[model samples]
Target: MNLKDKAKLLPQSPGIYIMRDSLNNIIYVGKSKNLRKRVYSYFIKSNNVTSKVEKLMKNIKDFQYICTDTELEALLLECTFIKYIKPQYNRLMKNYERYVYIQIDIEDQYPIIKLSSEIIEDNSLYYGPFINYNRIFKFLEGLNEILPLIKCNNYLKEKITCINYAMGKCEGPCIKNVSSKEYKKHINKVINFFHGEKDLIKELEKFMKEYSETLEFEKAKIFKDYIDVFNSVFKEYKHILRLNNYNKFIIIDYIKNSIFKVIFINNHNIEYVDTINMNNMDKKDLEEYFKNIYFKFYLINNKESKNIVTKEFIDYVHIIFSY
Candidate 1:
């Protein structure tokens, strides 16, 4: 069938639409709440569409859709296909290599907080797959200022001291002024802060207020920017941690009166999608289905590590986390 003819066959439901070129190679993958309306829009010529979308339409020779019970299911499936297929026009979430993480090598005598694009097997702790490199860099800069952690690279080097030490800003690990055991306390506080235990926001706010009262406007503004960056990034950091704690969970999305969309997530992976027609099933049958899912998936595939966010699935998790 022709492209327009195929589009007319799509149902009025939430789903992912795959656009293909004349060569039958997938070029674009997109999700929408209404498949028929969304797909049909492509055929209905509109000048308002972006140059990118117009370009995408020019290459499209065929299209297919996977019908979903709910928009959420469509979103999950769309991410799966985009990640695996790496479609030509699917731009977002494709550049996982550019995602930056705040790294801390606790294995070092004096660990330095640094931004890393790649996660290795080295025993360091990695905190993010954050997209904003400049924001993270600023947040870490302000964080090191408040925490008295080493901000200099001269640590364990032959250099006696740096300006940070002269101003009593760092604990002075380079000069052995603070032993590894003592300096670790600061790192532990940072770890606690990342874990959502330490209330650094309040403390930073206090410093901001103090600087403002003393007429140190520049310093106050500096702390203000720190707080801004912290607020933007830390919430997502905590969210990833919470999500990684779940090895398996079921998201039951109510589509209508008697239809439900069931998504089974295991180990940051969407394992299965099941649609249920509750028009015939009784309460007891519904309860049994949930119980079976809980026991079969949740109990058997419990999360092993609460803190570890694997670098491999960080981008995948980002897609779900954003949704």
Candidate 2:
């Protein structure tokens, strides 16, 4: 069948569409809330196609699509496929190294927080590979006030008072002033802040108000910037924490004929994700299968699990499951 014929067959639902060239190579991948409309739009003769899309269309001989349960699922699936497939037309996400993560090495005698572009496989905690460096820096600075962790990298001498300590910024772990237990408590606070336990926004608001009252306009502005950044970043963290009441939970999404089960297990610093395929199964059978699989996995792993489901994932599940 022709491309137009195949486009007509696409379901009017959310999905990830794969466009392949004559040689059966995937050239482009895209997600849409309405697969039929999105795919059919490309076939419209009157539609203006950009140079890139024009080229993409010229090579396109066949296409396939995976019907997702919701638009968010389609988006996530599109990203996953693009990362793995490395389609020629997709350029933005090809270089994943550009992403940055905030790393906190709590294992160190004097733990220091810093930014890392690479994902390090270590015991240290990493927050994100976020695009907003300015916001991350401001947020980290605000966190420093609450946690008072060491900011320096070099090892501290026994008697020398570092500049940070002199400024009352650090807890002076190098001088052994703060006991390891006490330092650990500070680290826990920082970890908790990241996990949405402590309210950085409230702290920023308090600081901002204090500075404003004292007529420290510059300082108040800085605090205001931090507040803005925290508001944006914390929204996602808040969503994750909402499901923290559940030690372990399963989110099942029935997409077209396939059932996608996302099993989330939350441990100390890592969130483990396992996907189960329960295609063409009844709800009762699916639940039984999930229990069997979850028990065996839990017994083998023996780790604490929590419901850290992403807002997008949960929101999409609600949309698809509602139908």
Candidate 3:
């Protein structure tokens, strides 16, 4: 249909509108507050792209739309539809479908834990869709550190706790040193941690106070450690502007298995161009995290080996802590 003909049929509601070419192929998927206004904006002379859109518009014949409840809904629906169709000319907006998040099935009878891009179970809660493996590993590690979660088994009652708990690294929930109810409470703390609410600090303080009053100094210390972790983590790293470098180059790298990301600052703007591998550190060490994560991500992405991640290089990354 012609522009004038198409304008009359468009609605005033929020929705996703698809523009088609002469061959009836979807060229673009767009969303807006008002379908009519959005579609009209595309038809205007200035709205036409000087380069690619010129060719697309010349081949345009008809279009389609799906109505949504609200503008934000329209925007979300548009993104979903775009991912589904992956229309041409929207190359920059191509979907990020690679990352998967670790979800804890808290509401289930056995609580099946797994990695997922989207949580399909309405019964369970999703912890993250973390794009980085290092982050995911830290999350699982942190979860294990504070909570009574069983990392080795699906069902808590299946078997006895592992050697970690025997060595004081765990709380021994698998053999029932901790109850399901208490485990659930720890899971709630994990939820609070993920939320990263300011009130979480307050709640942590309150919980610490209660534990101290009850003479549970060990438990209070655990909470204090976690609080310190949150503080140090928030302070040492950031994504926004920084004073470390004039270039303020941000190095964002993700490890493959977990939701780990490290934001490093450098005077140089170079990225994946230079490899700063840091993969030798063990999983339990907190000090070597940034190095371990960066190295694994670098190696995984580039298909390199640990020999490339030298001890001297690890020391260099550690020096940044002093800076």
Candidate 4:
């Protein structure tokens, strides 16, 4: 069938579309709340399509789409497909490998915190894939003042001492001054601080005030920069922490004749994701199925759970509540 005919048959629901070229190569991938409307918009000559889209349309031969239950699901699926397929016309979020993560080996006798660009399947706690490495490192450095952890690579060694110990910036794990248990307590505190259990902003404010009182303008300026960086990165960290409070929940929605389930667990971890086709079920049945599952998993009466749900899925819920 021609592109126009195929587009006409598209379901007016949230989904992702894959556009192919004459040789059947996947060239473009996109998502839309209304697949039929979005796909047809491309074929409209009067539509103000960008130069990139115009060029893409010229090579398009055929297309495919995976229906999703919600626009959020469609958005997430589009990102996954784009990353895996590496479509020619998709330009954003392709270089996910370049993103950085802060890795801490909690299993180690004396855990060391460091930056990582990849999340290996080690039992370590990984903090971020933050694009701003300098800001993150600076924030860590500032955090060290409030909650001191080891800053040296050669920790837990016998008869070795570092300058950090002399400066009182780190507990002396090198000289057997800090026991593994004692050091682990500090490490746990650092973890808690990262999880938003403690307010580092207050510490920053105190340090800034001291610097200014001592007439150390240089140090004051440095703290000011740290404050800015921390505030910027903390927003994302705060969101993840909120999601972590909910032990488990399933986000269910219907696209066409299929049900999509995205199960989030262990705080912000994605436990399971799948789509089930139920061609026999109608829209009313789908809504009933979703409500049954949602109420079973979601504790609406619990005030804390509601707050966590509100903060965690604020973006998705805002769109839903507004409608």
Candidate 5:
């Protein structure tokens, strides 16, 4: 049978479909609650199909699927397959290690703002899996100017003050001009700022106004740049902050055909996944089941491994978090 005829034989169930070229190499992996509908859609021609999809479809010589109990399982399985297979058609979240973040080394006696490419298990605070490096870099640069936190990498080694300290832009922690306690207070403000509790933008605007009123055009321009970066990035940053807050929680989702899925999350990693059939249990039994699983997993505090953000895991997180 041809690929189109073969797709028609697929079951209408939650599963992932693997598409292959004539060379019998798996080129793409996709999932759907209804395997037949999704697989069939790819075979049928449409003018609205994207160039990428058109190219992918043209190369498809055959396909197959792995049946899953729930859509969540299908999603997770798709992430795993794509990560291991490294299919050419699968693009997004593939290079997750390249994702950027704003790191605050809170473990240090004097914390400083720095950009990081990955998240690790440490005492430091991380602010993103931000995609745009230039934008985040600009925002961090502006933030360093607005906040009197440390700026130099040599702050721990050098006993003397730097250019930023001389210009009153740094608290001079390296020279003992600011105590760790006082400097950390500034770090707390930055933490609150990312959590959407503090208004750093308002302060930047205030400084901009003051410089403008005093006719210090050069200084005013600097503050204006900071305010502009904040305005552009803060909204998305707030959304990211909320997404990151999906730590240590349980997600119960009802799948079709009387199936319910329970996901145990800890520090953005899925600790466990289980499914129960509503048809098999009564109300009291369901309640007892939930209670058992809840107490079994919820009360315990588990530390995420240092290398928590795997490519597959990141895609899985995005799928469930968005759901």
Candidate 6:
């Protein structure tokens, strides 16, 4: 059958598609709802494909697809296939290195601490691909203020002698002052914060209330300070909700040595921000990986991207600390 015949057979439902070259090399992997419509749209002579697409089309000889239940399911399938095929025409998620993320080993007694330019299937949590190293560090410092979890293996020595320990700042893991249970609690808090918990402010409020009842003013102050930091990160929410609101999500990206990316949900959606430092990962490297990872980043969010006009985060940090 001709391309048109194959196209006519594509389902109107969501699914992942693959474009292969004469050599049977997969050049592109994508997902679409209404596969017939999306594939046909690509074949339009005037569609103005990207330079990469044009080259891909020149070598294209055949294609295949797997239908899915929903657009989101197609998205998941697209990501999976792109990783497996590492196609030339697809932009892979974490395929690029403009932003580097911090990876932690979830399986070890103490996981190895390191930086990553690639996404792993391991159960470990990936923190960022920050374009600004300084901002990433600043954010990590803020995180440390809320959670007393040790970030790295500064406890290799039998004696707890890290700088933070020496300075009487950290309750050393080496010293066992921080019990496993307490450490686990801090881990959960950090994870919840990063994963966009809508109840974050509420959780803090509850913790503060309990701390006050126990007369643990110092501990309560920590919660208050975090709330202050949280507020600084977001401009005053017109309406703070006890839950996530996902009408539309917008991006406010601050680019420097890392990308300090913020996800702002409008029309009552929750606002979540995350930063990753790709300072160590060069653009040339990420460019090579873009086909695999970059495409996972939905550019629809870019439609809403604009220069950051507010220094509210910086201003809030200053005002809250002045007290």
Top candidate by lDDT = 1
Judging by TM-score, tell me the better candidate of 4 and 6. 4
lDDT rank order: 1, 5, 4, 2, 6, 3
TM-score of 5: 0.72
Tens digit of per-residue lDDT, candidate 4, span 178-275:
78898888778667767766467767878899999999999999888877877877765665454445445565555454545544332333445556
Instruction: Flag the better candidate by lDDT, 1 or 5.
Output: 1
Model 3: weakest 10-residue lDDT segment is 306-315
TM-score for all predictions? 0.86, 0.63, 0.35, 0.61, 0.72, 0.40
CA RMSD (A), model 2: 6.8
Q: Number of clashes in every candidate structure?
A: 0, 2, 12, 1, 0, 27
Q: Which residue runs of candidate 6 sit more than 4 Å off their true CA positions?
A: 1-16, 45-48, 64-86, 92-142, 156-160, 166-169, 173-323
Which window of 10 residues has the lowest lDDT sum in candidate 5?
A: 303-312
Ranking, TM-score, top scorer first: 1, 5, 2, 4, 6, 3
Summarize candidate 2's per-residue lDDT along 94-139 as a digit string, tens digits: 5554545677788876677788876566888776545456767777
Give the per-residue lDDT of model 6 (tens digit) for 111-179. Answer: 433556666767776654434444444445555554454655557566645677666556677777766
lDDT of 1 at 110: 84
Q: What tens-digit string does per-residue lDDT give for candidate 1 at 1-323? A: 77777788889999999998999999999999999989999988877999899999899988888997788878878877887888999887566567788889999888888889887879999888787677888888878778888876657765688888888798678778888998888788778778886477777899999999999999999899888888888786866876866556677789998888788987777776788999989999999998988887777766565445655576667666666
lDDT of 3 by residue, 1-323 (tens): 57856866888977888888877888888887789887886678784367877776776678888876445445545655665677886753343454445577877533535666664637666543334444555545544554445566543555766777776765666666766676577567656555454445566677789899999999999778756655543343321112222333334344334333345333321232222334533555545655555665444434322122111122222233332
Candidate 1 vs candidate 6: the lDDT winner is 1
lDDT of 3 at 173: 62
Candidate 6 accuracy as lDDT: 0.56
Top of the candidates by TM-score: 1
Question: In candidate 2, residue 22 scores what lDDT?
Answer: 87
Root-mean-square deviation per candidate? 2.8, 6.8, 22.9, 7.8, 4.7, 20.2
By TM-score, is 4 or 5 better? Answer: 5
Please give the range of 10 consecutive residues that has the lowest summed lDDT in model 6: 308-317
